[model samples]
Target: MTNSISITKIRQLMTMISLILLTLSITSIAVRGFNWGLDFTGGVVADIQTKPDVTQVLLKSHLDSALSQDVQVTAAGNEGNWQLRFNDTDLDLREALNRALLPIDSNFQVTNSSVIGPQVGLEMVEQGGLAILACFVLTLLYLSYRFEWRLALGSIAALVYDILIVLGLFAVTHIEFNLTVLAALLAVMGYSLNDSIIISDRIREVFRAKPDGETDSLLDKSIVSTLSRTLVTSGTTLVTVSALWLLGGSALEGFAIALCVGILSGTWSSISIGTLLPRCVGLEPNHYKPEETESLQSMP
Candidate 1:
């Protein structure tokens, strides 16, 4: 068998790859945009109960044909429960939905129905954008206060990297970008921030303790010291998120997907970008060295 690559080489390779992927993610978002859901575009939302045998695909296909329009279908909390979204501009949504399900389940019931106007959708879009911007601004301020500028910037870069990659996945797949998915994005920022802070803290400690050590060696040592904690945390998180994705129903599928991607990306960024960016920007042990007081300097 061939020998495995060293951790040093691996870090170098991953850093290069991360930068390239980050560029592609930005490009994809710019060019393709997102598949905005009814939450942002304004449409009818209906929760219905159908025959137990009715699947999302079957229901969607029939609705598409009967209503003569596109319909978005997702499984809700329980079997036979589904949420449907579609434009209601020129349709009697309740009547159309009831008639469409007649053949599949005569007893089918429309449990709830609501219409989201274009103006409301626009307002939600604005509010969601502002919330994310606000989060970034707050995160930067906190990180800057806690760490040196290089480390602070590194953590922010990792957050951006993780977010862009997740957004790019949604854009490329044309997944519906809804409020639930937006909530997941905010969760991702928090997770990424926590991971970055842990790794950065360890690096700072190691740097101060081994002021004479080589940068690469000190970084490797610091990361290795925290490797087990990172793996366990990430592994447990992936397990929970995997269950959520598999069993949480379609209403939460986007949310679960976002968390899964965010966890993995956050873990990788914590180890790679968080450390690499600082080193690239000339981070040195002196930055973490204790400052001398005027009295001590004068006496010395």
Candidate 2:
């Protein structure tokens, strides 16, 4: 009993610490503009594999001298491989940098290098924003039809908050928001809403089951009853997502992390906010009568 209490106390403290850290991160990001990536801002990626002993600063120095333009170099992979992120949309600059850096190392080998054009990058940003917006609007319409308008509104609010929090995480972390990250964010929208809908359906059933239940109490009961299932489902999801996060490689890491965070938040809001919509509209779940559904029909 003592150990369990101690662990719980420790966990509570840890959670408080984490929230404080996140607050600090957001404040810092607000002070400093976002750390935009090459994908959104447009630039060239120069990935090179060289002799095992080559250093990034040396590579930067050599390339910087030869190209007559500045560049930021990131060392990736095992000791020999490196990735250079440069601020330019020039194919010629890419080729020149590759050619110049190759000779510096006895076994200098260019693995992959390319310039991402600004126009294409801008188009991707535009399309991604539109896709998210369209998904949100369409989901609202679908839930309104399948459930009730109030339910739809509640679920969408959670969805919007989930997405914003995810973006806020990204912004605060200063992670690279490439196209892959956008796809992950888009995926969160559907995944989050699906969880919300499940709870919404349950709330409707709860309202139906207890015809004389007060609306608030009924919602509370519905959420409390569904709590176990939500935790179990989210736990299972976290297992797989955590596995992916641990082993998904750099390509999928950002997306996986975003999904993991959003899923947990989605589950939380489904119980807390999603079920409270009817209560906010002055419906008492525990006191609900069978005609309560009809009452909602005339609510708007």
Identify the candidate with maximal TM-score. 1
- How many clashes in each structure? 0, 17
Task: Name the top lDDT candidate.
Answer: 1
List runs of model 2 lying over 4 Å from the truth: 1-33, 46-85, 90-113, 284-300
In model 1, the runs with Cα more than 4 Å from the true position are 1-6, 49-58, 74-82, 292-300
Q: Can you give the TM-score per candidate against the true fold?
A: 0.89, 0.72
Residues 1-300, candidate 1: write the lDDT tens digits.
111226667777888888888888888899999988888989988899988899888999889988887898988889999988987666887679777888888899889988899999999999999999999999999999998889999999999899998998888887889999999999999999999998889988988887667778888887888889989999999999999999987778899999999999999888888888888999887678666533465683
Q: What C-alpha lDDT do the candidate models reach, one value each?
A: 0.87, 0.73
TM accuracy, model 2: 0.72
All-Cα superposition RMSD per candidate? 3.2, 6.9
Question: What is the per-residue lDDT of model 2 for residues 112-146, given as tens digits with 9 covering 90 to 100?
Answer: 87877788778888998999989988998899888
**C-alpha-based local distance difference test score of model 1:** 0.87
